[model samples]
Every structure is written in structure tokens, then in C-alpha cells.
Target chain A: MIRLHLPQPLSAGAALVPSLDQSRYLTQVMRLKLGDAVLVFNGQDGEWRCVLSDILKKGVVLKAEAQVRPQTIGPDVHLLMAVVKKSAMEFAVEKATELGVRHIRPMLTARTQGHHLRLDRLDAIAIESAEQTGRMDLPVIDDPAKLADVLEGWDPGRRLMFCDETGGAPVVKALSALEDSGRPWAILIGPEGGFSPQERERLRALPFTTAVSLGPRVLRADTAAVAALTLWQAAVGDWER
Target chain B: MIRLHLPQPLSAGAALVPSLDQSRYLTQVMRLKLGDAVLVFNGQDGEWRCVLSDILKKGVVLKAEAQVRPQTIGPDVHLLMAVVKKSAMEFAVEKATELGVRHIRPMLTARTQGHHLRLDRLDAIAIESAEQTGRMDLPVIDDPAKLADVLEGWDPGRRLMFCDETGGAPVVKALSALEDSGRPWAILIGPEGGFSPQERERLRALPFTTAVSLGPRVLRADTAAVAALTLWQAAVGDWER
Candidate 1:
């Protein structure tokens, strides 16, 4: 069955038209004929079983049959990663999506070098990942913002898992010691050059932040994001059965 | 402060010669003159502080001043990952080395596609990752072998953590439930298309195998490797300080 993350509202008896790109992909690339089964899920609606109803010259229309799965959400975990190079940034976003993060915020640090970040490309990657990973909804990809500004407007209710490289407690020990409340959480990853001294000091002072080191060695930004998410999920998030 | 991974036996007051590639990198690229401090480490020896003693046309010679850090090893964890594409395979190796995996064995499965794997290239990646991540040792990259053969010759004492996508116990719960017997462990990650049914059955029947699911969604081969390592390290490996 072909799974797609569509933006249009999905219902039992509504018609949905795919985008031009999707239309060409379905007709020309995949050669999905009329009446072929296709699973579609809007971010707001549950996953729906649909079939190609009509194939037009420029597009294709789909008719929903039934909802195969209900709307579900994963644990509220966000990733705030300093943007690295183009390839690394995209790779991190895709991995974060697969790891079931709720949101992705591109962070800007003093040593951050990747300035040409695009929101649309990241959204596309998230959508593709969600479709492939069986995720019902897409993670909200926030715009790139300065780390200081993000910290200033932060909510105290959500604890932050700061992946500090210079010095910190071990990941397992620090997270195992934490008391799990029903609050949100986020993981912070710095750039390849790492955070400046001033930024590190400020982050260390945050009350909700729990600075934890991955291990004895240093990791690239993308790898750190994946490792941090894995540890956080296994410790407190949705990795438990 | 530059770090280099040298294969020669390192010791105090020993003159070491670098490869031609390293020679150009140190003299032409890095522009290191005589008496410049350089950190060198062999997989067997502790990290040594070396200084440029002689600049040769073919290679550079360095004198080991002192051992800056003692030789240390992380938890004995091996990664048995099926060969993925070129980029994903290399990325997984790099990440595994940074995560302190002791050895990496490329497993050939029914759906494995990347056949042009070079041992030397993978070794280079491991060495570079070790140098960059401040790791005291490099992971041993084993030759690629059929999954069945490797499992047939496997030692039953060392447990295998299989990342099964179909169904199994959750990662955290499953890993935390295991007894800490100080036995070596290995993580088994399937190919992009996943393990064959026969292979899966064989793995499940093994007495030492503990099949665990990452989450509801499926993950790529590289992502799965990192996640499994993170959880395993946290549960029983050396993540606790």
C-alpha cells in the first residue's frame, strides 16, 4: 500500500486532489492506476484508506473509503539543533522525524555557519520521513532562530536536555536521576564548532536544563541529535512498551 | 592541536614516521613546522604528545614527548549491521566509532544491496572518526560475511540485541530488564528491506538473542544502529559515570 502525507482534509467520503508533483509521481512514476489503494493522512485527521477515483490530464483525484488508523500522537519531545552544513541539517531533520520528535527548531549559535537553511525543504523531508516511518502526523519544523531569543521566550514547564561536550554528567546517570513529570521536553545540540563559552555558561544556568554528556568522545551535530533523542526516549519518552 | 591515528607502536622518545598522505596533510595542508605539538595514538597504546622532528619529502617524522592520556576502552559492544548503500554504510561506521563500539561486522542479508564495500575505506573512516571524537582507540572493522555464517560461528555467551521491526518488547523496558552479567553484547541491524523471514526466525530462536523493537515506526539502517547503541549503552554499557 502506498502511504502519503497529504495536507488536504481526509474524511470517509471526501474527495482529495494531490499536488501536481504528486499527481505526476502517481500517474507517470509509480503508475498507480485508478482503484489502487493509497493510504493518506493529513496532520489533523487520522489515516484514511483511499483509492484513485479519477485520472485527469494534469492531476488525479482520490476518494476516501475508510479510516484505517485513528489520530495518534507520540511523546512531546522537541529537537533544537544548531544548523550545520546543508547535508547534515537535512539528515538530522529526517532522523529526528524518524525518532518521533514533536517539533524541530533550527538553532543559531555564535559559531554556527550554515546560514542557507530553508523551511520548505525541511518540511518535505519531514513529510517523506513520516510517510515512510508510519508516523500519523508530521513534526512541526520551526523557523531558524537565535539561541538566546529562543531561551528568553522559553517555557519553564518543559525541561531541556542539553548535550554539553565540555563537561557534564553522564547521559544515563543524569537522566535516570530525573523525576518524570507530565511535562514536555527538548534536546539541544550545538554546531560542529560547538557553543561559545558565554553561551555554555548561560545554558548551564538554566533551571530546567539538564546538561548531559553523550560519552567520552565528541560527536558531530547530526550524530549528537540522534544519540540524544535515543537516550531521552529510552529514559523517559515513548520507547517503553 | 591536531590528532592523528598512527598504526606504529607509540612510546616515549620513539621516532615515528607518518604515511605519505599524512605527510602532505601535516606539512602542506596543516603547515606544521618543526617542534609543533601533535597528538598521536595507536589502537594499542595511549595517546602520545609528539613533536615534529624531521620534515622529509616523502613523509614526516615525529618524536613522542609523553603520554598525555592512558589507554582506555569503552564497553565491549559490537555492531553487526547489514550492508546498506555507500553513504549510509559509511555514516553508520563513523557514528558507531564515535559511540565507542569495539568492533563492526558488516552482515550480508537477503536484501543487502551495497556490494562494493572496501575494507580500507571503512578503516579510514573509523580512524578519522576516532581522531576527531577524541577516542583512545579505533573500532575493528571486520570483513563482510553472510549473516548465517556469522551467526553460526557466534559465541553464545555474548548476547545479541536484535532490532526487530515486526514486533517485540520495547527498547528501554527490554534492555533494562536484562541482568548485568558483564558479558559482551552486540547489536544486530537489518538491511533497508529488513531481514528475511527465515533469518528472523533463526535469530529469534537463538538462546542468546533478545529481540527488541525501537518504536511503532520503522527506522533506516543507520538510524537504527545509533538508537540501539544509545539504549544499550544507557542500560548496561559505559554511559553511567
Candidate 2:
């Protein structure tokens, strides 16, 4: 059965009540009919087994049969990347969601470009990726914020593993030093031009930031995002278990 | 200074010889005249500091002044990914080179599309990546070969870690159990549709292979390639040192 993220609260024996948009998708795209089984999950309520109860001209309705799995949170990992070009940024966002990132913060740096992000399209990408990857939750995508503003209000307990383009400590060393603390963490990757001198200085001065090297080579922003996340996942995330 | 690969052996006080293509690049594209300093490196010889000695219509010559760094190989990690679509495959090859992968083997699987890959273009990408990333060594891109053939004639000393999409043993567990005896290793990533059932069974029967899961999500082949390599580097490569 195809999985769909329904907006309404889902409980045992409750009607599915898909929105008009979702109903079109179920009827037209998936060609689902009455009595067809579909897995439905609301971010707040747990996942539920649902059956199409009625198909009307305006919309389709589903009846929740039973609760399949309880709502659960993903690992406390966030992917923070400077807004890259349109195609690359979308690719990074899709991969980050698949890799279990719970939040994606698009950073606006001195050299960052802003007019490319389509918030609605990106949100759809996240939902589709989560559904395909068997993720029960979707990553929250925040509006792009200036780099200085992001660091100014940084959480002290959360460590930001900055992928320093100039190269610094190796990722393994940085991860080992921070893994025991259990701090909610974020990985920051710069844009194509990289951080300006002032931005670099401010980030370096922040107490919660640690500069780390992915390798000797200079990876593209998108590649850096995935590589940094992979390193973090291997070193400190649930992969260890 | 822009670094370019001149795979010929460099000797102390030897005259820098630019090829016909390189001569055009220096004189036309870069607009460099006599006495301009450019960096050059060969895979076998170390990086060299060269000053343009003469500029002619047909050719250009430079004096190799000094050695910047000795030739050294990166971590002996190879990336073997099943060939994907043209653009995605090229992107993987470029990123793999940038991330310090020493060898790239494009595996031809049963379900692989027989799209002709341009070897010359991939080689150029590797060279350009090495030049931009400050890596003295360029990764070697091998001709595409069958996965079963590559695994059948594999070296016994080198370990092969396959990214099993079915999520079996956690990757960290498989990586930790790998004995880092300083032997060359490779990471194998499957195609988008994943390996066929028979192919998976055959892979599992291999004694030198390790099946690892990249968390719960179904990652694209490109993302899985980077994730698997990062895990390997952290667990057993120079990062551990």
C-alpha cells in the first residue's frame, strides 16, 4: 500500500478525511478506489491503516481501521546548508531528508543567491522522499536566514560541525570529541563561493561551532552536505547501535 | 595559481614543456605571457613550481623551479558504483575524485543501461577536480566492467563492502568488525532499482564481502556511494589515525 501523509488527526476507527488535494492524488494519480487500503500518518497522530470509504466528485473519504505505529521523532540532527543553485539545493534537500535529518535550515551567506527556492515544491519533495524511504516523519524546512542571525541565536547545547573549506580538524576527531555529550547537532556546509572572511571569523568565534574537514579535496556544496551528514551519522548518530 | 596535471615525470631544473593543447590554453585562454608562474604536477612526480620561459606561436616552455610537495597517494579506497544515468554517473565520478577516492570502477549490472560513457570526459573531470582540490594525485577511472566479473576476480586481501539496501546489519557494525590491516578496500553501491534477487544472493555468498545498511531510508545510488565511503574512511582510513 502506498503511504500518504494526511493532515487530519488519525486515531483508531476514525474516518481518514483526506484533503481535496490528497483526494485527487489518491483517485487520479494512484487510481485508488473505494475499499482500497492505504497507509496514512499524521505528523501528530500515529500511523494508521485506512480504507477508502467513499469517492465523490468533490473528494474522496477514507476510514481509519486501526493504529499501525505510534508517532515517533527522528534523530536530533539538522542539515544547515547555504542556499545553492536551484537544482543542486533541491537534490541536497531530498538526500538529507532520506538520510534522517529532522530539520533543514537554508542559510543565506554574503555570496548566497536567494530567488531560486520554491518552498512548496521543496516541501513536496520532502514528503515524497520520506514516504518512499519509509520515514514516518518529514523534515521541517525553514525559511532561509542570514548566517550571522543563525549563529547569533545558536543553541549552546547543540554543536554545529562546520565543514571548513580552508580545512581544519578531521571529521573523526571532531566527532569523537563531541559524541559523548549527546548534544543535538547540526552540520553546516557553505555555498559555492564559500564563506567571506567576516562570516568565517564570526562563525569561528562562536562557542558552539567546531570546524571540521571532509577530506583534502574541495567538494561541491551539495556533496559536502551529504558527506558531512554521512560522517556525523557514522560517528555519532544511530548507526553506532 | 591554477594547478594543471602534466603526467610526465618532473626533474629538478628541467624545462617545462607545455603540450600543443596546453600551449593554446596558456596563451589563449589564460592569456599568460613569458615569466608567468604556474603550478604543475604529475601523478608519479611531485608538484612543481614552474615559470614560463618562452611563449611562441606553436608552443610554450617553462622552467621547473622547485618542488612543492612529494608525490603521495590518498587513502587506498576505491568507489565501485553501478552505472546510473549519464548525468548522475558523471556527477558521481566528479565527486568521487574530489573526495579522495583513488580508483573508480563503473560496475555494469544486469539491469544497467548500456549507455556509452565517455572515458576522456571522465578523465578530464578527475584531473580538474584534483587540480582544484589541492590533491597531488588524480584518481584513475577504469573502464566499465560487470559486477560479477569484478567480484569474481577480486583480490583476496582487499575487502569489499556492499551497501545492502534491505537494511540488515548497521553499517557501523560492519565497518567496526573490519580489520584494518592496511589492505586496499572498496565500497560498492547498487543501481537505482537495486540489485536483482539473484545478484544479491550471489553477492551474499562471497566470503570477502560485507553487507552494510545505510540506516533505514532508501538512498539514491549516488548518496549511498558517498555515505558508504565516509563510514569506511572514519572507521579504517587515515581519519582513524
Candidate 3:
């Protein structure tokens, strides 16, 4: 069951109060009434089983029964993709979150040819994805920034696995070199038009960047982002651990 | 540049003869005349560079210059996803093809809901994806079959890494264990409603089945299919090799 957003803190030993917005969804949308059960989870606390107590004009009330599972951190893997079309970008973010990305950085590259991103709409999609996927914590969605700036300010500690559209070293070579090293890493993917010659050169020259190929095929930006992340996680992230 | 379908083989010193359809695309749509360069590739032969010779109503002619890279097979991986909605299913297939899946098997489960499938359209998507990705071979698309039939006639040599929605062992565990043998493998992912209890039980009983979890999240059927395939390829296929 999906968790509803409640206004106030869920008291451990007190009555459970679902927000008015959620109350309407529960009563009107879901047709769930008093005495009906629902799963509740605050991003702060563990998931809970709540029973409806009173359906008030303002909202509805419930009493917490027990905790299902506590909120835990997912992988340290982050995905940084050059902003593509709105639909593809949204799909990439949702899939990245589901694949256990802790941070999503939508970078703007020289070749990026997309419109303004609706941050609120993107956030809602992420939230709904998290709720549906049973993810306790939603990924941190960072503001979009220029690729050059993001690279210039990059820390040396985090390994940057750049998904080279030109098809460089086999992904296995890059991934195997990082195995057994407990290091935080991120995957970089290009937009639809792909990286310009200068941008590609700059990325390839970065000391922290490790260029990798996603096989022989040219994947769309969204697909590349997800595939690169999946490869990273399986090769070196918590999947191997 | 996306590879264009040209007549004749793509071998060195071979004369190209574009059919009427390709001639129209080159003359009318692309507005390319004589002496314009284009990239062409045959599934068996490597990609090639050719210069347009003549633009005739009957056909277009071109002469091959030099051979590109030799044809190389993609990652030795296959995907089996329960049939989903039309768009979602198409998205999954396109992404899978871009991610270098060698084969795609669509299945129908007991709890499967959606039914509309446009096989021809999906095939076109795969062809376009391959042409865009510079793939020398197209991934085989299989017709939808009953889940029980797929399992009962399972090959003993091939391992089936089933994505269990109920949360079994993390994907990494099963992948690591399988990596040692380096055997051929396929990933089985269920639909939105997931497998029925009996379906799950029968799957668990299969000697070739290894249930793996796609983390703690409940990803959609399409996302789960891609994630499972990526993880499998990384753990035991070309990524590790």
C-alpha cells in the first residue's frame, strides 16, 4: 500500500491523523471509510499500519498499530544526465529512483536542446514513484546546472563514470577496476544530440572521469542513464557487497 | 549518423544500389544529391562509408569507400517480460534493444491485465533503435506465450534469474554466484500485479529458477525488466568478461 502524506508528526503513542488532502483520497477516491486499514510511513519514521478511528469534516483519524520497516538509506550511486525531452527526462528520473539512485542531477550540456523543466511536476513524479516502489526515502533532486560547471566543481573523491556516446573502453574494463573499492560514484549520460566535440574532449580529459561504453548500441539519454546506473550498481555498488 | 538501408552488401569495393524507397528518402526527404556521403551497414558485414553516385527515379547508386569496424555481437543477454500496456511495452522493448538485449520474450501470466500488442510497430522500433545504435544485428523478438509453458520447457543449461516481487535474495547474490560459471542466462520479470501465489511457487520449484530482488522498491514491470537485465549482464555477461 502507498503511504499518504499527513500534515503533522505521527505520534508514536497517540492517535494517527491523516491530512485532509489524504483523507479525501482515502474516503472519496479509494472509498475507504472508518475502520478501514491503510499503510502509513513518514519519511522520518518506519512504515505503520493505521486503523481509521473517526472521519471528521476536517479530516480523518487513525491509531498506529505497528511498524513495518524503518527508513533506510539506499545506494550511494547518483545519476547525472543532460536534460532531454520532458517525457524522457521524467521517465529517467523515475527509473533511476526505482533502481536505487540516491541523488539525481539534471545537467545542462552544450548540446542539450530541451525546454524548461517543471520542478514541481518532476518532484511529484518522484514522490509517486517512491510511494509505488516501496522506497522509504525519496532521492534528492538537485537543480539543473551546466555540465562544465558541474565538472569543474566536482570533488576528486567521487568516481565519475562517464557514459561516452562515442563508445570508448568496454564497460567491463572500467567497472572491474573499481570493484572491492568502497567509493561513492556517479554515472554521467549525454542528451539526445549527444556531447559536442569540445564537451566530449573536456569530459574525457577530466582526472575524475572514467569513460565507459553501454555496449555497441546507441541508447537514448534516458535509457543510457538507467543502463549505466544498473551496470555500476551490479559491478561495484551495494549489489556486489 | 543512423545507418541507412542500402542495396547490395557493405563489403569493401562493393557498388551500392539503393532501392526506390531509399532513393526517395535520400532525394526527397533528406535532400541529398550526388556526391553526398552516407553511412551504410549490412547485418553480416561491418559498417561502411559511401558516396552517392547517381540519383535516378528507378534507384540511387553509390560506391563504397572503406570498411568501418568489424561486426561485433552485443552482450549475451535476453529479456522476458510479462506483457504490459501498449506504450509501456513498446518503451520496454525499445530500451531493451538499446541496452543490447540479444532476445526479447513477451509472456502472459495468470495475473496479467493488459492485452493490446502491436508486434509490427514494436519490430519497427527495434529496427530503428538498432540502426541508431550502430548495431550490426537485430535482437530477436518472440511472440507472447503462456508463463507456464515458458517455464515447463525451460532449458537446463540456461539459468533463469526470476525477479520476485515478494523480495527474496538481493540481485547481487544470485548474480555473483552465477558469475563463476559464466553460463548463458535470461531474466524473467512479472507484470504489474506480479505472479500469483501458485505461479511463484512453481517458479521457485524449478531447478533453473533463481529468484532475485530488484532492491527494496516495487518497480513497474517495464523498469524491473530493464533493471534485471542490466544487473545480469554486469554480473555474468560481457560486462564481467
Candidate 4:
């Protein structure tokens, strides 16, 4: 069954008025007709079985039938990545959602080139990726902020996994050492030019920061994010469950 | 320094003439002049510093300098993946090279969509990735073969890590169990449509095959390839070193 991410509260017998965009996706793209079943999730009320109840010129309406799955979220893994090129940034967001990241924080570092990002565009990408990857919840994409400011008001309780391209302790070992801490974690990936010297020093000096190396060969910023998340999952995230 | 992948054996004091494409890239695109320094690597001879000795109309001549780094290869990890669509297949090849795959064997499964692949195109992607990722060696792309034929001649000494989208043992757990064995390893990732029932049965029943789960979510074929490679590296590949 096709899955859709509905933002409104879901309940049994509630009518879901999909937006024009979604209606075109369902009616025109997917060719779904009235009475066709689809799975719907509101990221709060869990997943529900729904059917197209009405089709109109402007949009389509769905009637929720029954709740299929209880609401659940993945581990508290937040991705704090430096703003990269447009295409790479989009790729990162899509893959992060599939890997079950709970939040995505785009940071502006000294070497970050582009500063502008359409939040709506990223939100759409996240929603589509979640729907396709069977994720019940969507990752919150925070507005882009300066890395220094974000770190200044940081919660010390949450561990920061800094992916240092200049080489550090192996990621598995660094993450394994934190296995007993039981703290929420975030991964920070630098830009293509990599973290500036001052930024690296500040991160390395922080008590909450654990600098981890992805591997011997240098990886592009996007690849580093994926590799780091995978290592984290295998070491201390939900993959162990 | 610009890096180029030269297939010929390289040695100090040898005059190296680049291909027309590489000459255009060096002279026209990069605007490199005679006497400009570049790094060249052939899978066998490690990396060497080369100086542009002559700039001709069609090609460029280079003089090999002292070796910069000794030849090194990543862990013996092969990738056996079903041929996917053109773009996704190219993406997989690029990522596999960045992840230090030693060999890539494209297989034709029952559900594989594309039957033909441009080996030269894939080789170019791999070379570019290897050059950018600071890898000394290049992965050999094998001719496409039927999965059954490839399995029939499989070496029992090498272990196969099958990334099954369906539920299976967690990848970390599955890989941890293989820590004691010092045998070579390869990863198998299916196409987007997944393996046919008969194909899955054959894989699952194999004594040397270990079915591993990436996570709970359904990952596209490209994502699965990257995640599996990351898991393998962290568990038993060079990342552990």
C-alpha cells in the first residue's frame, strides 16, 4: 500500500483533505482512484489505514479506517552538518532520514560556502524519504545557525560525535568508549573545505566533544556523514536492539 | 595537487604522456602550465609527484618525480550487486570506490532492471572517486555475470555478507560472530525490487552466506551498499586498525 505523510491529527473516520500537491501525486501520478487504500501517518497518532473517499477537481479526501501501528521514534541521533553545496546537502538530508536521525541541524562554519537553503524544499525531501523508508516520524530540520553559537548554548549532557577529517581515534573505538554514558548523541560533519583551524581547536577542547575518524582515506562531507551515522548505529544506536 | 589515474606502470625519471582527455583536463580545464606539479598513481606503483614537462596540442608529457607514498590497498572487500538503473548504478560504483572496495562484480538477478553496463563509464567513476578520496589503488570492475554462475564458482574460503532487506540478524551482531575467522569477505546487495524468492532461498541456504540486516527501515540499493560497507569496515576492515 502507498504511504502518505499527513500533518493533521489522525483518528478513525476522520476525513483527510490532502493538499493540491499531494492530490496530484495520488490522483495523477500514482493513478489512485476513489476507495483505494493507502497508509497514512501523522508522526504523532501512528500509522493508519485510509481510503480515498472523495475526489474533486481541487484535491482528494481520505477517510481514516483504523490505526495500524503505534507511534514510535528512533534513537536520539541528531546530525549537525556544515552547509555544503545544494545537491550534496539534499543528499545528506535524504540519507539521514532513511538512517533514522531524529533531528537535522544545518550549521554555518568558517569554510561553509552557501548560506541560503529553502527549508520547505528540505522538508519535502525529508517527508518523501521517510514515507518511502517506512519511517513513522520525521526529523526536525532546524534553521541554519552559526556553529559557534550552537555550541555555545549546547546541552552538555548530549555527547557530540565530531567527524574530524584530519584524523583522530577510530570512530568505533570512540563511540564504544561512550557506550556506558547513556547520553543523547549528535554527529557533526564538516564542509568540503573541512573545519577551520579555530573551529577544530574549539571542538577538540570541548569536554562534550569526541573527535572520531571515519577511516584512513578522506571522504567527501556527505559520505562522512553517512559513514559516521552507520558507525554510530552499529556501535551504540538502535542497531544493537 | 591535481591527481590522475594512470594505468601504466610508473617509475621515477620515466616520461609519462597523458591521454587526450587528461591533457584537456590538465591544460584547458585546470589551466595547468608546463612545470606544474601533479600527483599520479597507477594501482601498482603507489603515488608519485610528476611535473608537466611539455604541453603539446593534443596531449601533455610529464616527468615522474620521487614517490610520495608507498602503494597500499584497503581490506579485501568485494561488492557483488545486482545491476540497478543507470544513475543508481553509477552512484553505487562511486561510493564503493570511496569505501575502498577491492573488486566490483555486477550480477544479473531475476529482478535486476538493466542488463547492460558501460564498463568504461563505471571505471571512470571509480577512478575519479579513488583520485579524490586519496586511494592508492583502483577497484577492478568485472564483466556482468549471472548470479547463479558467480555463486557456482564461489570460493568457500571467502565469506559472503548478504544484506537482506527482509528481517534478519543485526549487521553488527552478524559481523561480530565472524571476528575469529581471518577469511576474506564480500558483500552482496540486491536490486530495488529485491531478490526473487528462489534467489533468496539459494542465498539463505548457502553455508558461507550470512544474512545481515542494515536496520529496520527499507534502504534503496545504493544506500544498502554504503551502509553494509561501513558496517564491515567498522567491524573487521581497516577502520578497526
Question: How well does chain B match by TM-score in each candidate?
Answer: 0.97, 0.93, 0.89, 0.97
DockQ for the candidates, in order: 0.63, 0.45, 0.42, 0.71
lDDT of 3 by residue, B174-194 (tens): 667655444777888898889
> Worst ten-residue run, lDDT, model 1 chain B?
B172-181
Residue B126 in model 1: shift from native, Å?
Answer: 1.6
Candidate 2 TM-score, C-alpha based: 0.80
Structure candidate 4, residue pairs in collision: none
- Give one digit per residue, the lDDT tens place, for model 2 in A1-241: 7889877878767876777888998999999988999998777777788999999888998999987888876679899889998877888888898788989999999989765788898999988878776677889999989888888788898888888887768776678666553559999999988899888888888888888877655678988898888878767887666
Write model 3 residue lDDT over A155-176, tens digit each, in one string. 8889899988677776755776
Instruction: Compare candidates 1 and 4 on DockQ and give the better one.
Output: 4
Task: Order the candidates by DockQ, highest first.
Answer: 4, 1, 2, 3
Which docking band does candidate 4 fall into?
medium
Q: What is the Å distance of residue B46 in model 1 from its true position? A: 1.7
Query: How much is A76 displaced in model 2, in angstroms?
Result: 1.7
Worst ten-residue run, lDDT, model 1 chain A? A173-182
Instruction: Tell me the number of clashing residue pairs for each predicted model.
Output: 0, 1, 2, 0
Each prediction's TM-score against the native? 0.92, 0.80, 0.81, 0.96
Span of 10 residues, lowest total lDDT, candidate 4 chain B: B174-183
RMSD (Cα, Å) of model 1: 2.3
Model 3: residues with Cα > 4 Å off, grouped in runs: A5-8, A12-29, A50-67, A166-183, A193-210, B5-42, B45-70, B167-173, B176-183
